[model samples]
Target: MKLILIRHGESEANFANYWTGWLDVDLTEKGVQQAREAGRRIKKANLAIDCAYESMLKRSIKTAQLVLEEAEASFVPEFKTWRLNERHYGALVGKNKTEMTQQFGKEQVQKWRRGFDEVPPLAKENYFDRRYDGFDRRLLPKGESLRMTSERVLTLWQDQIVPRLKSGQTVLVCGHGNSLRALIQYLEQIPVDKVDEIDVPNATPILYTFDSLLRIERRIEL
Candidate 1:
């Protein structure tokens, strides 16, 4: 089985250096190019993608579309779910990371950003977005630690992605940084404290090949 994971390209908030958790934002021009490049890379590697997955957010969805178009794999089935969205930053959404560091000390902000169990402050009110109308309100979180993000993503992997892989399908996942990180953590079995060291660059693909028993045979980056 093969799994390919790509983080969505740069967003407006990314350009502005702000936290954009759960915010719907479009990709920048360079981001579009990056997505296309990722697809081209996949083609060059001669990997036959059978299915794709993405988050509900526009940036991820758009990246998946662009990638499929460039790869000429639009016929592949693509699934979108909120479970792949970025970790909710709560009140920190839209706040500049550097400014937040100044406001709450560098160490504190670092913990909130990278610590597996360190959840930030919750949002004052729940956002009533129509994109999530059909989902259970309880499933929507105001804030989440990396551990929390991993739990939800793991559910999707176990229930949806793993079965597809077991059927000998090559799956592509276009998602956000934190969400992709969560998946990587599971794939690599990285320790909780060590997860902080893992960084998923935007629009880059991480390819994994698994044996019949689901043990990793190889990991490649493209």
Candidate 2:
């Protein structure tokens, strides 16, 4: 089975150097081009994607749409789930990363950003977005550590993605940096402390070929 994981293209927040968290933002022009390039790369690799999955955010949703269109695989099944959204940054959502680092000290910011269990400060209130109306309110997080993000993401992978891969299906996942990192950590069996070293770049696809038992046979970046 084959699995392709792509982080969503750069968002306006990313271009502005702000912490995006769960905020909904559109792709910049360069981000759109990057998404197209990613699709073309997938096509050039001759990988047939059976289905695609993305987070509920528009940036991820748009990337998936653009990828399918560019790959001429628009007919493929697409799944969007909140479970794949970026790790909630809580009160830091709109803060500038550089300014935050200067104010809080680089080490402290690094701990909040990459530490396995160090969750950032909670948001003032729980999110009340209409898009998440149907989901359980308690499931929404005000803040999350990488470990917490991994738990929810792994649940979705085990329940939704693993079965498909086990049946020999090829899947494409367009998601955010932290969420994808969480998934990669699980798939690659990276140590908790070592996960801090993993960084998923924007609009790049990480392709994985799996054996019958779902062990990774090979991993390639495109």
Tens-digit lDDT track of model 2 for 70-140: 88899999999988999999999989999999999999999999999999999989755799999888889
Tens digit of per-residue lDDT, candidate 1, span 19-121: 9999998999999999999999999999889999999999999999898888889999999999999999999998999999999999999999899999999
Model 2: worst 10 consecutive residues (lDDT sum)? 124-133
Give TM-scores for every candidate, taking all chains together and pairing residue i with residue i. Answer: 0.98, 0.98
Cα RMSD (Å) per model? 0.7, 0.8
Clashes of 1: 0
Alpha-carbon lDDT, every model: 0.93, 0.93
Residue-level error in angstroms, candidate 2, position 94: 0.5
Candidate 2: regions farther than 4 A off: none
